[model samples]
Each structure stands twice: as C-alpha cells, then as structure tokens.
Target: MELLYSNILPLGCDDDERTIVGCFKEQMKNSDRVEIAVGYTSNASLNELDALIDRYAIKKICLTIGMYYIEGMPERSYHTALRVNQHWKASGIGEIRIVKPFKYHGKLFCFYKNEKPFSAIIGSANLGVIKLEATNRRQYEISALTINETEVAEIAFHIEQLKTSICSGNISDIKGMPLIRETNTSLDGIELVTAVPQSSVEFYKNCKTYVSFFLKLKVPRSVDRHIDDGKHYTKSNINVCYAAPRNKRKSRDWYETQLTVGSDIYRMEGYPNKNEPFFVVTDDGYWFKAHTTSDNNKQFSAVGDELIMGRWLKGRLVAAGIVKHVNDTALDADRLGMITEEMLEEYGCDSLLFKKTGQTALDEKGTDLDVWMLSFVSGNDYER
Candidate 1:
C-alpha cells in the first residue's frame, strides 16, 4: 500500500521512538541517494544512527545546526553524544547546511532553506517523546507523510524564502506562517503530509484531526512489555487533546469542537470528543487552556505533561509512570532500562531489575553508582 500521507513519530519522543525507530529500521533499505535531516527540541544521537544509515546504505546526511546546553548540568552532553555529523565517515557527506534558529514566541524553528528546493517533497515532524514513542499505552499520535512533488516544492520554496530572509538578516519583524496559523491547507500531491504548527489554533486543529486520523488508519499495534508495569494496553474508543497554552502568542478565540458518538453530538471548547473515558493532555506551556464541563455527562481529566498516559486514571485506565524529562539529562540505555524497571516496580509492574544478569552494569569509572538516570521520583519530578 502506497500511503499518500504517513505520520512520523520521531525518536527521543517518549518511549514511542523505539517503535518509530523499529519501523524506520524495518523500512529503511539500501538507498544510494537517501538523506537524513533532523531537528530536535533538545539534543540528539548520531552514533546509533550511523549504524542505521550504514545498514541501509544511505548516501547523504542533513543534520540541523544547533547545539543546546541544559542548565545546571554542564556535564550533560545529550545534544552531541549521538549527532548526525559524526556519521559522515570515508564517503563524506554530500551536504551540510546550518539551519539557523528562528524565534516564535518562546519556541525555536530550524530554518531548512538550502536543501528543500531541489527536493521532490517536503513536510515537517517534531522531535520529542509524544512525536516518537510507540510503547506508550495511554494516548496515541500520528504523522502525515506525503509524496506530493508540487506541495513539497512549494514548502521547500517557502522554507528557502524564510532562510534567505534569515541569511540576509532582513528579518526585523518576522511573523510565522500566517496561513497555517489561520486556515488549514490541504495538500494536492504530497503522499505523506504533516502540518507544521504555527500557533495555538493550528496546534489544536492538528491534534483534533490527527488523533482521529490515526485512530482510523489502523497502524498495527505491538504488545508493550514494560519492565516495571504490566503489559502496556490500549483501550478502544478513547480520545485525547493536548494544547500548548498561550503566554506570549495570541490566544485562540473561544472555539468549540463537537464529537459525535452514536446518536449524541457532544460539544466542548476547542477539541472534538470521542466516546466515554476521554483524556485531555496538554503541555503546561500552551497559551489557552482546554476545559470540559460535566454538563455533557462525559468523562474528563487534564494531563499537564508533554508525555501523557492514554486511557483513564481510574477503573479500566490505570496510572502508568511518565518519562518526565528524558531530554534534560544524559543517560545510557542501561540507566534508561533500570529506571523503567524501577518505576515499573514502584508502580506495581512485574519486571525484575538486578535479577536480569545482562542488564545491570558497573560504571565506567568502576564505581557501582548508576549513570545520569532520570524519571519521576514523585509528582514534582517533571518540574525541571
């Protein structure tokens, strides 16, 4: 099946990235002309990726040109540890363009101007747990992948224009993409088309539609054998909403979306609804907040973290531990695995930690101390 648009859940996004990486690894073949470009919210890895590209025989590489330093953790080298530039050995990279940072409110965008114009397609996907994870049992995510030549060209040109402006330093009063922030534009030829979020309204719309889209797409699900927790399970007929609250950007006017289940058309502010046990997840960072009243007799709750558990927190849906801030620190896989196992145990999961012989390890300095592991020590764990 040729998907005109395929949703990409990029890596480093919650645990879902393992699924994306698995799928990508399964699909990526020996492409002589392949190019890999990535822009992350925090840092990235290039070493493990080198093996992937070499395994697939990818010919080109396009790594974003920005480095980040998480405050208070100077030894934390998450950004450069697994970088794309390090992947270029022997054959050397065909292109290396620096996508300078552009500001929008408090967010940053890596302007991809140089490469897209000559490309056959164009689209955007974010780098994070929500965008990347697969084992996350609670809420699901979707990426729109397109093969449209013209639409890709247009997007490429637009990026180029933005880049040109940035290069010339003529951006005195730069405004983001106005049309996306205002109206939803459909693609004409793109096979996998993902919309770029330019504002709160645009983000709301994407969340509303994309969640529905993935629900209908039927991407095959895999059994999640979480270490601490029991098998990660997903309940059918679920709904979720994540809104990035507005603090500096313009607020979304009171917009309402209606969700129809069976004979009832239930309405709420901004997001559309699904059946019973609907969960709303939002980054505490959004400008406008999403609210639902019990007036409709619908189940509701708000998840404040970027990485949220799907289903409900009661009865059928239980509380699973969250990956509060994986990006903020640097941890090896064993540390990540240990934390998962420990959390699973803490939350009544079935995984055995020290019992797994191959899993446990001593530090490089020969110390028995665990590496820079991170996770929820408790409720206030994600504050950093």
Candidate 2:
C-alpha cells in the first residue's frame, strides 16, 4: 500500500516548517527537478522557492504565471510576475512561462527525477508572497499531494500542454502585464463599538442566545485599574465582515475588523490564533490588553475575578475565568475545584472563578475560542 493524498498545510504550518519544506528537500535530494505552476505569483514567494531550488541544486525548474481573479491578487503585474520573471533567468532555473488576460486560477507542482514525474501537488493556493512568506493560523488555501504514478503523469502532461499553448515568454516579454494603483491599508484608524455594554456579564455568560465572539482586551492599569465594575447593558454599532489571524497582513476593508478594550480600539490583523491568549501585561504597565484568537464564537465561563466585579461595577482585572459551555452541568461553582469560599471573599467575586485547566476540553458546540476571540474585538470596534 502507498500513501496517495496528503495534507501540505500542517506540513508548512504549526511551527513544523521542516515537514513541508523538508518534503521538497527530500524530493530534490533524490530528483533532478520540480515544476511550479500558479495562476498568480509574486516576487517574495518566488524568492523563497528559488532558494529551495538552489539549496537542493535541483537542475531544472519551470514556472507558469497567470492572472487569476481572486481576492488579494497583487494590483500590479510587473511588480509581481514581471519583476520576478527577470530575476530567475540568471539562476539554473531554465524553463519559465507567463499566461494572462485569461481567468486562469490554478496551482500545481510536479517533482521529477530526470524527466519522469514521481510526485505532484495541486490545489487552490496561489504561489504569492502571502502564502510563501507567512503561514497564518488559517489561510484561504487547500492543497494536497498525489504520489501515485498515474496521477503524476496526468499532472506532468498538463504542465507540458500549458507550456506549449499559454506559456509564452517571460513576464517582461509579455505585453499585457502592467503597473496598477496600490490599495490602501484598511486597518489604519478604524472604529468599532461594543455589541453589549461592557457590564453585561450575562451577554458573555449566556452562550446560547448571544453565541458571539469572545474578546479578551487588556485595559491599562493607568487608564482604568477597574478593580470594581459589574455587568450591565448591551448594544452594538458595527458588524464583523472578516477576521485576520496573525499571519497574512492584517489589512481589510473599512469595518472589516474591530477589537476593543474599554473605549480604546485595536485592529485585529496578522497575528496567530492561540488557545490560551488571555492576559498580557507590558513592561512599564502603562498599556495592557487581553488577547484572544481570531475566532468569532467564543464565550466566557465566569471563573476568574467574577467574584470581584460583583453585580454592577467596572475596573481593570475585573474578571478572570475559564471558557465552557453554558449548559454543561459540570461547570457549576462547586464543580470548579480551584475556587474556595475564602478565595471568593478575598477576590470579592460573587461566583467562583472557573479557570480553564489543562484537563479542560473543547465543547462540541461550534464555540471554538478562535471564532469567538475575533468576534469579541470586531463587535466592540464595529460602527453604527
């Protein structure tokens, strides 16, 4: 039996970059060349690929560049493929082709020993600066590899056909590729509003009705050492259109993202999503904010500092707690082994804090903290 289809994302992502790149290195170690075809391409991504080719000393390389209609496509063609088109020729990479003016959007890779193909990868990921340079917690891509001889032959044949037909000259030799205007960054100076008033602890506690993004924003001790604030009212002015996990540049259209702490607004962008991205304190203690994943469906389990916040007050460090399903009967105050009566009195919290333990498990409900974290910030920074 042989492995057929395999996931490439977990290979390149998850702090295990060696797996994905190593896959190529291993292939290059045994093979003479690998072919890369992407409807969209960029210089930064190409540079990384070129480095790999050089390191393995893969003798032959070919590229098929195209202009696919996709979001995040570079605005200018020359700034993209055209510039890279000129850069690769000096190297041992001998084969390159440019295709455009057509709605071409496909990514393919074929690795070969001599001229025969042994492995190939195909998918929706564009070989662009964003994909090659950074691996976000999540991306707009899905790719897989097929090592079956039959599949590799079919892929190889397709590449040869593309070269004979659409692959005409380098990006510079092509006529239509042009320079275009640049798009502005959307994250700069954006506005957001709270979905519910900060005091409305019930809004965060009741996951069934609100089922919203759980945002953990840190308030500066200088700004509001909110040792005392209770839950209260609710309202929202903005809606979340997108979320940026820390990887791809955090640029979106107006009102695309919003993270809020007290009255301050922070744009969520180019950051990784973490399971436990909660409390963060700076060196001077002049500024601080809670961190949450870019997920849009997180709910808070009133386990921390809740006893201190009481019924109706506000302060920094007002609440600390675990995340859990509201209906999970195991989530009761007594079931929470960490909190004691004396501790609750000392913290001045009414409910026992439910700190998430290593033994904690994710709820079957779609309330993954990743979804809720982004929602929390976006809602608070949303517009009316």
Candidate 3:
C-alpha cells in the first residue's frame, strides 16, 4: 500500500509523479482499462481523461458519476456530458453513467490488465482534481494505492456492481432531470444570476426604462448562393460563429461564440469597445462577460469561455425542437443544416434583440460596467 497526497510539495514544483494525475499516468502504462466512480466531475476533467486515454491507448474507461442524481447537474455540465457521451459513442471508447436511486459519494479508480484487476486507488479526490487549471485556490487530497490482489479485486468488483443496470443509467436516459442554474461567483461577494426569470412580462415591466435594438438574421443572396454551392460558405451562417479553427492538440469541439455585427449595428454608442469587456444579462437571466473583437469590432464574444454563449443560443433552439442536439458522428455540413432560416422561421423568430437595461453591475474584475440585456424571444415587437 502506498499513500499519495496531491499537495506534498508547492504548486508549481509538484511534478507529475507527485500528483494524482501523475499517479494515474503511471498506472495507465501497464493497464488496458480503468473504472472511475466519483461524486462529482467537470468537463475539464473529462477532457483530461480523454487525452490520457488516447496517449495510453486505453481500451476502455467507464465512469459512474454520483452527484448529479442527488444535487442535480448544472446546465453546462449536463450539456457537456451529453456531447462527450456522443463523442465517445462514435469513437468506441467508453461511456459515462449516473448512479441513481441513492447517492454514492465514493471515489475510486481501478486499473486492469488482461481482464484482471492489478491495482486500485481509493481516495477523496474527485475526477476534477485531475484538471490542473480547475482552480486557483490551494487544495489537498489524500489517497492510497493498493497493489494487493485481494484489495484490488474487491474495489473492481464494487465498481462493476455500480455499473449494473439496476444501479446506473446512461447519461442520455436522464434528459428530463432538472438542470441546476449556473451562477458566476467570480465577482467580489456578488453572484451573477444566470437562470432565466419565470415571467417575461413582469421582468420587462419592471425594467421599463431601456433601449432596444433588433438584429435581423438575413443572409445576403450572394452568401446564400455560396453556402448552397458547398464551398467556402458550406456551414450555415447561424453556425459560422461557432466554426472557428480549433486547437488540434486539445481536441476541443466548441469555440467562443461570436456574432458578427455589421457597420450599421456597430454604430450603437453603448456597445462595448473593441477588446473592452462588459457584463450582459440575458432576458433569459443568464449573464456573461462579453467583448467586441476583430477588425471594426465586428465579433461579439463572451470573454475567455467558449461554451456559455453558444449553449445559451443553441440550447433554446434544441428546447423548441427547432433543431436536433449536436451529434459527433454527423458530418459538418449535416450539422450546419440543423440550424437554418426555415427552422428559425418555424420557431417564430428570425432575429435577436439587444437592449440597454439602464442598470450597472460589477464584472469579475470588479470593473463597474453598464449591464445590457439580450433576448431572442419569438416575436416581432422589436422589428423595424
């Protein structure tokens, strides 16, 4: 038996061999499969595991997450889990499941060779600990590795039991599970609300003093012809914002959502200046830091994060049954076809509206900025 502590050395000085990530990498050298049962996890952790699986040529990895069943998963994590599950399904790698009926808040990792359990790590570290950039605060996790045949087999058997049909279900099976609201706690002592308010009428009435602008989603005839040709404009204009070049090394599937503003729209005086980020509270209650980038400040994007804004817009379309949820196996052209002018028209809205809410909020950096409101409701009230 060997005890492992993640914070034995200073943060930067801690080498791979001194951390849980290092320990897992070492075990993977001789293992063909791994089983993980943890209370909680994040997309970043799954990404790390995905990289390790590829590097080690791991045949199979099964994860049974337990926290979502009891506390409810956040909207971001829920969507991410769905996308990753689809990706894994297409690649024939592994699957992620949620333990149900009762919460199982145990953390265990068992490694196997030749279908036999050879070693196991039992500890307090959730999978999130594997992500080096997950947090800035110092954290300490203590775990023990057991090479005893009997102990290793016992742990593996326990994980196998958790994976059974009676105990767990694939992530896709829980689509009806309520998603916990996402909030930003980065602001000093102030949490930014990210859940849509229940009543739209009441919200607008309360904030009567505001300025609004309607953004029509009209594709130029030339651009539409090019898209139809399946050449440079092969992807839907709606998805062009998400079509940025990804880092091949990281294998990231999404990019920071950017909505290109024309010169006419750019004339709006209150919009954030090029590279000057500000806070935006969506009519649906979600809030994110946004900035304008690129030539003529045409690209409007959420600061630092990729998933938030994309999920916000695309999720609504999915919920309305206007388009199918993203599938990893689908061709890029097919995925692009999912969001079209016809779908937006069917949904009763073909544009988005931005409004100045006549309010102010402090961003993550404690910079006081004007808080704007964004909406994509199905209506023509704001139409020119």
Candidate 4:
C-alpha cells in the first residue's frame, strides 16, 4: 500500500513544490468518475483539468462550485461558474453545477480506480493555479489524500449528494451514480515512478508506463561469486551495459549480472533471473527519498539507464504470470511451482536466493521484504 502526501505549496517554485492539481493527474488512472468541490476556480485551471481528464482516462466528472464565495460574486465568481458549467455541458462528458455557499471553504476531489472509489484529495488549495509570488503574496494551503475505503465512500457520497441537491443542470454521457466498490485488497495499486530515455519516450509512453515499478538498479556486487570464471560486468558488459536515465545519456552502468541454475551452472549473455523481485532488480527507483536510521532524506537523481518492465515478450521485465491466492510472505523458489509452469522453468532454479526473496544474501536485516502474491513479469518467457 502506498501513501502519497504532497508538500505544502509556497511560491516561485515549480518543480520542487508538488502542485495539488498536477499530482491529482498522476494519481487517478484507469478512472471511472471524477468529482471536485472547489471554493474558487478559473479558466486556466479548467484547461489544465481538460488535459488531465484525457490523460488520466477519466470517464465521468462532477464539479460542485460554491457560488456564495465573495459575499455574492454575481459578476465575478458566479458568472465564471456559469461560463465553466456551459463548457462542461458542451463537452458531453460530465455533470457540473453551482451550490449554496456561506463559508463553504473546502476544496476536495474524489475519483475512482477501475470501477470503484479508489482515491480522494481533500485540501485547502482550490482547483485553480496558484500564482508564483514571493513570501507575503502567497496563500498557504495544505491538503490530504485518502485511499482508505470508509473515508472515500463518505467523500463520494458527499459529492453525489451535493450534485443531487444543488446541480440544476446535469451533463453526462453515462447516466448513473459513479461506480463505488466495497474496499477490497485486490483493487489496490501503487503510483508508478519511472524514467525513460528521451530517445525512447514514445516507445515507453506507449509500452512501458505503469504495469510495473521500472527503474535502473546497479548489478549485484556478488555476480562475481556466482559465476566461476566469467565476469559479467567486465566480460559481457556490452550486451548488458545499457544507458540508464535515458538512451541519450553518455555514461552507462553495467546492470545485468550472470545467474547460475544448477551444478552445470547455466550462464547466458542476455538471459536474466526472470523471477527476481523488483527489490533485487535495483536498490533505488528513478527518484527516491530513502529512510535513514534517522529522518534526513536521501534522493536518487536521474539514473535510469535500462529497460525495466512492460508487455509480455517485449520488455526488460516481461509479464510472466500471477500467483493468485497465495499467503503473504517473502517470495522464494519454494513458491515458484505454485505460480505457473513458465515461472518455474524461467527462474525456478536453486540459483535464486536474493532475487526471489527480494533480499541480500542471507539478509537478516530484512530491508526489502514484501508480501508475495502479485502477477510476475520477467525479461524472457522461458530463459530465452
């Protein structure tokens, strides 16, 4: 389960401070219905919303506007609200309307993942762009997101109720209440973080985004001990050494390491330990703030230099198969036979120690432990 929190927005900073609206675009994916209750809004924010709705694949939208914001913005906020409502109505996409407001100072967004209420944002920021200004000119705002079932259900119902009570005009191609599901563990998914080479942007945008946590991790230092005489980093570095962060990068890291299967010790130039847990694939993601023994942050910068995960037979880590109904435990070779025949053949060898368990060799520290029972993806189907 991933819990993402946005840093408070100030001013004069674009990339550093996480925009509440911008982050919303990334969080809602494969969406069903999107609803926003904004105390104040504008055309710029609406244009950005239009792009976000398309990019995030939102099916339905609800905008609950507060008309009584500034004593009575009959000319300003009210007129703008009516104008915005017309745009949403013309699009043939969703429902929008003005609502009663006397100190209704709240900005909230609730949306679904797949067919259920999956995530929500409840915060102080409006659905409009904040101006970049110095200290005194900035209005401090903070908000919190909820993936929790009980809270999302309440928020969803609130949006729905607001629409029913005040929305005189409704706009929707799909005429119904938004899809809401009783919370289930299976519906949970993480926000994907990735880095694609500039040269491969189109390729990755189409093929590699989402599906897996893709990043470039360095080769295991123990690769030398696994293979007898063959030094993968020094010997077969060309095939394995790929540009990370992006294909345009000048310096590349040797990411691939040799694997041993049995007494025969199978080692191939391009073959990977397909069953490897992503924990062993690499230590850090495209960008990460690691936990210290204390609270200081450690960020890993633009270091993506390899293909990670995507469609079956077409990615660095190809979709192998899923192991459904397995108890949550650290993944190991003992559990390989339970998942799929392909998994057993591809990475079921005794050679797997760290990759299967997502830990270092005999790691008592348990740094990378995870509950195992999700779909598995790998480089090749059956050891290529």
| Top-TM-score structure, candidate number | 3
Model 4 / residue 381 / CA error / Å: 72
Give the per-residue lDDT of model 3 (tens digit) for 1-384: 887777644544344335676787799888999899999887577777878888889888888999888778765566667667767777887889999878889999999998888999999889887885537236778788899999998999999999998989898786445455444322223233355465742454357545666666643332352344443332323454324345544323432244667788877776667997777776555667777788988777677665566566666666544455554412444344335566665455767787766777786667887766677765533331
Q: Rank the candidates by lDDT, best first.
A: 3, 2, 4, 1
TM per candidate comes to 0.28, 0.40, 0.56, 0.37
Q: How displaced is residue 276 in candidate 3, in Å? A: 30
Off by over 4 Å in 1: 1-27, 34-45, 65-83, 89-91, 94-98, 104-124, 128-139, 156-384
Model 2 lDDT tens row, 209-326: 2222223422122222222232211001111112222335442222222222221112333232333433221111111112333333132212132211111111111221211112
Alpha-carbon RMSD, candidate 2: 20.7
Query: Candidate order by TM-score, highest to lowest?
Result: 3, 2, 4, 1
Which candidate gets the maximum lDDT versus the true structure? 3
Flag clash pairs in model 4.
Answer: 94-171, 197-246, 243-305, 244-304, 244-305, 245-304, 245-305, 318-378
Query: In order, what lDDT does every prediction score?
Result: 0.27, 0.41, 0.68, 0.40
Candidate 3 regions with alpha-carbon error over 4 angstroms? 8-17, 134-137, 181-283, 286-384
